[model samples]
Target: MKDKTLLFINGDAPKSLPSPANYELIACTDGAFHYLKRMGFPLDKLAFISGDFDSHSGSDEDMYEEKFILTLDQEKTDFHKALEIIQDKGFSEVDVFGGSGGEQDHFLGNLTVAFAFKDLMNIKFYDEFSEYYFISNHFTLKGAKNRMISLYPFPSVNNITTKGLNWPLTNESLSITSRIGTRNFAVEDEVSIEYESGDVLFFAGNKEIEYPTIY
Candidate 1:
């Protein structure tokens, strides 16, 4: 990790990127390095590459070995290994791309990691249409005033309350199998969210999501 790091966790990322990208840290997990190559990005731009190498072919391994490689055990996923490197460097915030566009299990695992480390740093999982984040504390959402914000429990939501939303909840206990906060709207400049006791994930999105497809 560098002063700033952009870690890719072996998922599907867009082919086009902003010119003179702002990532001070470019990281990849196992085959994510190869994915970067497929996107026409240079490996030299990566500060670190880590993973269990479970999906890496021989040629892919050699290609990534030209740079930094941190081979991990099967016990931990590639995303977890990348998090270790990120957290060890004391980063305050991480914008994770390519996480939500991969295998279903890995995508869910990335969400778990974001929730587990919510207190450590601010993380945002980027997909094609939206961004997902687990909120452990108070935060303000600012963007298009008409943006759609949905809140869902991570199988253990205790009590949640909200303000400046279309359908506000007040100190309500949410169940694991409930979609109580789905499809809420932002009514103010910034919607305030507060929750206690359980994990809560908020998805702010506008575009329609194509299920099971990373393209």
Candidate 2:
């Protein structure tokens, strides 16, 4: 049986929330739970709420005590600790929301955390503007015609090649401080990307496209 995806909400609070019915389980950090409650999200749908509970009051704790997961590790971010809980629960595919807004450093920190767990699970991040994730060395994206697509090297990528983009790369090298591929669009329905080494972050424009099933 195919594992149903886990929907995780972070602290930043997305402009919109995805339908909970699409996922097998729904979870959020304490920070995100506040926004979700204000937005009238059904708390019963959450499997567990994980965080240090620094912002939660006594009554708040009393109400959802069974669902609260106290993660007091000061070394890791709540986002990171939450993923560890998900991993322990045996869910490998996760769709994250509210990870990109608020503070820029937090956004970058979320990306860093996602990168750390990329090998353990399929983690995709969604925001109002786009859905992005770390891609394997070779990836094929479909239904991307006329949409903005960005292939960014986390730090550096080598011997990169691509097809079906308006401006394709062939055996090219991209580095963060040197050269990175961004603001590129797909001209065809399908796009293929291959690279010899290093990690690549793929960003697909969220407008007009159904949530991609290819992931």
Best by TM-score: 2
lDDT of 2 by residue, 131-171 (tens): 89999998999998877899889989999999988889999
In model 1, the number of clashes is 3
Q: What is the lDDT of residue 41 in candidate 2?
A: 85
Instruction: Give me the overall lDDT of model 1.
Output: 0.71
- Summarize candidate 1's per-residue lDDT along 106-183 as a digit string, tens digits: 788888877777877778777666678887657677763556788878875766888877677898877767555787
All candidates: TM-score: 0.82, 0.92
* Positional deviation of residue 83's Cα in model 1 after best superposition, in angstroms: 0.7
Most lDDT-accurate candidate? 2
RMSD of each predicted structure: 5.5, 4.5
